[model samples]
Target: MKNFLSALAVSAVLVSCSKKEATPVPEKADTAKIVDSINAARTKINDSIRSKNHFKDFSGPHTFTHNSIKNPGSVHFEKIKGEADHYNIKGDIKSGKSYVHIDGFMAVVSDKHMNFTGNISESVAGSENGKLYVRRGTKTFMSKDGGKTYRLQDMVNGSGFVEYIDIHF
Candidate 1:
């Protein structure tokens, strides 16, 4: 009987030791979803560039003001004809010192729109091989590659918004 009890205790220990908690298997990432997201970002960047190009033939003086709740001040552009035609841009932001007297090539200007292409001369943001677009009383867009890519500079409550006030040519 004593031997049998000892055997039973050993069997119980073995049974308990054999039971194990299952480990969870790792799930694979969805490659198709990742690819789709990347494609969407590329499409957005391309679209922005194309939109900036739409105003490539515009010139003359212009002003852009934020229409949103956020007050980023304003931007002003004046085309000057000289040895090389260029535009002087002044951006007055409420937060810091204004970007004053920046120069870029005035590529084109129409009755209601204007475009400026930047080079190494301009010290403003997006002034390196960039382009600025302004449509009268509508919107403003800036690019870093002569309209090959663009971004709306106006912000609404600190978030990016396309709307601008009196973006006149």
Candidate 2:
């Protein structure tokens, strides 16, 4: 009888384990909140007015890659010494205003990769010295190496135009 009881208990356990969980179905009306949430989401970053302070100011060297466009490239900018407090990211818009922070449903559709150069100097890692760009708003990008000493825009080439480092095949 004990053996039979143990087998029954094992069978019950297996049966219970085989049961599947139901996925919760959200109410249809709840999805209506999408439009309302979008309207209310206009508080900061993507929705706010852009300025020089919208993006980050750095005190070291860093690598930034622009991977959102059909084609992509990179930039290596080094932070000038004694220029942190006065640091500014200078930028202008091509179609609309720029952002200083991350915001909204704005998919930063472009992929980006950055490596911060912690307290880097001209002595080592040899930085590119005078490259500048505008991301959005008034925030501008700056580099110090003919825009090539550090950042590798191999996919594109620099131009007199400030935005969109034009790359031609």
Candidate 3:
């Protein structure tokens, strides 16, 4: 009986020793999913910031109305160092297969007024097809409704015509 009990104990020990615990397998990283989540988070943060500071963040796409014709355009506004409510502006407008580019500075004089001084560069259709004429001039714009709308008193290439180019924000 003692021999039988000792053999049984030995068999139990051997079986226990042969059994192994399974190790967990690591998962492969999904790089595309990670990147998409990161981009979504960044966009959310940017939208929050834009909502809080819409006036300062008006540096994106805008309507560039010139000669009663509205054009699609984009503007970049950078805050000037050491200046209050001043910005350096640069933008381009797509006008009927031609592009009009402007580089300028803007000053927020008051809550209801703003001023802009810039140089305009535009390509005009010449007398013949495929011929382009470049027009360069200075422009001064004023906004009385807190940048909601701007009136261009000075135009590109000429003045006595009193051309009004509205820049709608």
Candidate 4:
């Protein structure tokens, strides 16, 4: 009887020991990169105001119809550009704000109007994928579905800064 009790206690202890520890979820790795991209796109768009010929945003017709351009033919996916209509708290109106940019491409999330607060994380199909931008040249751009995913021939042109304002895209 004593041996049986000892065996039961030992089995109980072993069973409890076998229980696994909860694995910690690692944090997203590319946060800073995304922020940088969004900032760069914003800067490029801002620059466009003074020069209409500034870095342009290309889409369906712009990508395919133009014989001067070449690509995989059609956007990897399609990102719709959303308008940025918000302004500073100090009563300063943002003429047009487009904080994000894609190379010759761009997209605006249109589910609802978004307000950027200097800090932004990429959102797509409703998921917070990655940081918005990284350095291509002197400007930044945005990525929606992590770096791996993309929107086909989409762009938000006109104002560099993003606001609720609409664009050609």
Where is model 2 poorest over a 10-residue stretch in terms of lDDT?
101-110
Worst 10 residues of 4 by lDDT: 89-98
How many steric clashes does model 1 contain? 4
| Segments of candidate 2 deviating more than 4 angstroms | 1-68, 85-137, 140-169
Provide the overall lDDT of each model, using Cα atoms, as 2-decimal numbers.
Answer: 0.43, 0.31, 0.62, 0.33
Model 3: per-residue Cα lDDT at residue 59: 51
Kindly report which residue stretches of model 3 are placed more than 4 angstroms away from their true locations once superposed. 1-61, 68-70, 126-139, 144-146, 155-162
Clashes of 3: 0
**Which residue runs does candidate 4 get wrong by more than 4 Å?**
1-9, 19-28, 50-169
Per-residue lDDT of model 1, residues 25-107, tens digit only: 89999999999999999998876664453334334444444333233344555544331223565544332222223234443
In model 2, the number of clashes is: 22
| Weakest lDDT window of 10 consecutive positions for candidate 3 | 124-133
50-76 in candidate 2: lDDT tens per residue? 323223443332323322222233222
Q: Candidate 2, after superposition: displacement of residue 84 in Å?
A: 2.3
Clashing residue pairs for model 1: 58-108, 58-109, 59-108, 59-109
> Which has the greatest lDDT?
3
Which candidate number would show the highest TM-score if scored against the true structure?
3
Sorted on TM-score, best first, the list reads: 3, 1, 4, 2
Q: For candidate 3, write residues 1-169 as lDDT tens digits.
A: 9999999999999998996889888998999999999999999887665445324444545667655335557667777654456778777766566556767877765554557776666543321332333334444566777668776665533322343556678
TM-score of each: 0.27, 0.17, 0.48, 0.21
